[model samples]
Target: MKYPIMIRVKQKQIAQLVSLGKRLDGRGLNDYRGIQLEVGVVGRAEGSARVRLGKTEVLVGTKIELGEPFPDVPNQGVLTVNAELVPLASPTFEPGPPREDAIELARVVDRGVRESKAIALEELCVEPGKKVFIVFVDVYVLNHDGNLIDASALAALAALLNTKMFNYEVKEGKIEVKPGYKPLSVKNYPIAVTFAQIDDKLVVDPWLEEEQVMDARITITTDKDGKICALQKGGYGYFTTQQVLEAAKIAKEKAEELRKLVVKG
Candidate 1:
């Protein structure tokens, strides 16, 4: 993940600017880059969304299929999340099985959605123990500006919002599809905000240069009620107690702003 000599030089300059409460991109210390979101981008998928944050881009698709419930969770439906770091997105990415970074990205997003109770899985059940819907949320990273975790999480939630469940009928032990669809049952909105630290400066939604120069990064996911649902800290650096608390506050405010974009009619 080492950048060229010139990119590293730029990282130092960016750090210096951040120390002065400025960014190379002219955004405030706590400001996010421009974001654009679109839902229903993939017609074949039950649900899909694409999100762009500055130069980073991601797409998420949700597919619902009828499957047997897990033995331990027989009364509830299933939710699985997978993230792919496409090689075309960055030179650092390789084409193969999921790497450590990709696994971490998927787990963080999954933790946020699962902990927030965003989807009412119980309602997805068609039969108590035998039949239920399996929701597969797949995240594809199109660009690697900096914060893939936030962008992917947002796209996943938005896709879920746009999802339509296939109409189905259950008989003695079989389920049959009908000709209609209904909206997926969504309960809460959970959004993630990421902060990167360099020297003593903290910046929200760091871009590629800032990310490469950062010491550590922390991501806080908050629900609509302003409660922390999940927390993830990456890198070899650590955040102080006060810094973590301050990041939470920043995350809550920014999360509220981002939620509007997802739920927009």
Candidate 2:
């Protein structure tokens, strides 16, 4: 949600271009920037993925640990997500407690995966409620250009998909690791698409500049089945009914593209 002064000027120019049915980056209104994904980039983490959406970059790491399941979901495993906006990534981000923006980013990414039931928690249950495998997904912002939500979600999904859990045995209430590995029990693939409304023009995958001038933002999550799993809207700007419908259509299209990329790896 941070914007620079140069970005503000670019927004004005983008707005002018939007009025002419064009974008400053030469993309159509619903066009998305190029995406580059790399998996297993971090040697230390169990699983890791780095995503670059134009100038924006995000890294996600997945770690697995043995733990007890929640009381209500005794048969299901747990998945936790955390995000950090590193100071080194952006001058505006400070080294301290997480800000509200960071919290929101984590929650948004979590919702997309959790709500979609992408990971089959029941499959992670080792010994009912007594023992289970917990997957911890951490997202680190390496650079802030725009659309952190989408980039973070993509990174998280890719990381989880590539994660592997070690073989273990529960003996007399003590869990012990064996010498084997299994891919994480992932059920569905979820992808998030974000749209920003700039000067009454709804644009998909807003650059940093367009995000600064946009009135409101909308994010839609879709599963591999092409069903909407979650939706989140923020900012003070309002969108017309037609714009909302159009945005949904655009989201579905982008989701398909992202789904293919995630599955390819």
Candidate 3:
């Protein structure tokens, strides 16, 4: 499908400028747009957060419940992530089951958190191989200006950081609720940075316009230790080995910057 003439013109203009380390939004090639974050947004949720990256916005809520652990990971708790692209968020989105983009978004976020071992699942187990706590991370897109993955990932992490565990006691395989609550054990902080390849140059936190003109996009996720935990590539374009390595280095630095914003000491 061909983009309308105006869109093509915009694409060409954006791409030309990006080749010169410039962006239509006045950001440098490696600069991210403004970010705003708020935690504990949902009173009824175990944890919740809202993150706005440029014009893009995402909300994440976490719910915890007692459930059986997976057979293979019987000793550890479960972590599941789901994403919804609300119709009001974008004209392109419609109300229905999760589309491919929504599924991909959830998977990317899940990989980052799971690979980094951000949540101390082992500590959530009530009984070995019998019962455990299940953490559900639900990501909702409230606006779609681009960089949804980064915003969603940040919100998920922030929500998890704000998560509180219910106090309970196990007696004869039965759980008894207690009056007090405790903070969830989060062992690591993982941050995701997404880059778009436009005019052969990679730009950080591409806005909606930049994303439409990009060749490929790749997301790099790093843990609290500055070690890479996950990587996902999308679009039809491919990055060279050197490009990937360079992106990794930049991603490490960017992750640290983003982590500080979402994680408090």
Predictions in order: lDDT: 0.93, 0.90, 0.93
Clashing pairs in 1: none
Off by over 4 Å in 2: 1-8
For model 3, how does the per-residue alpha-carbon lDDT over 1-265 read when each residue is reduced to its tens digit? 2455776789989988988889999999889999999999999999999999999999999999988999999999999999999999998899999999999999999999999999988988999898999999999999999999999999999999999999988888788999978989888999999999997789999998888778899999999999999999998889999889999999999998999998877
Please rank every candidate by lDDT, starting with the best. Answer: 1, 3, 2
Question: What would the per-residue lDDT of candidate 2 be over residues 1-265, giving only the tens digit for each residue?
Answer: 6666787777778889998889888999888789999999997888999999999999999999888899999998999999999998876889999998899999999999998999888889999978888999999999999899999999999999889889888788777889978888788899999999888888888877777788999999988888888888888888898988888888988999888888975
C-alpha positional error of residue 179 in candidate 1 after TM-score superposition, expressed in Å: 1.2
Better-scoring candidate (TM-score), 2 or 3: 3
Model 2 TM-score relative to the real fold: 0.95
Error of 2 at 198 (Å): 0.6
Per-candidate clash tally: 0, 0, 0
Q: Tell me how many residue pairs clash in candidate 3.
A: 0
Q: lDDT, candidate 3, residue 10?
A: 95
Query: Residue pairs in steric clash, candidate 2?
Result: none
Model 3 deviation from the true structure expressed as Cα RMSD, one decimal place: 1.2
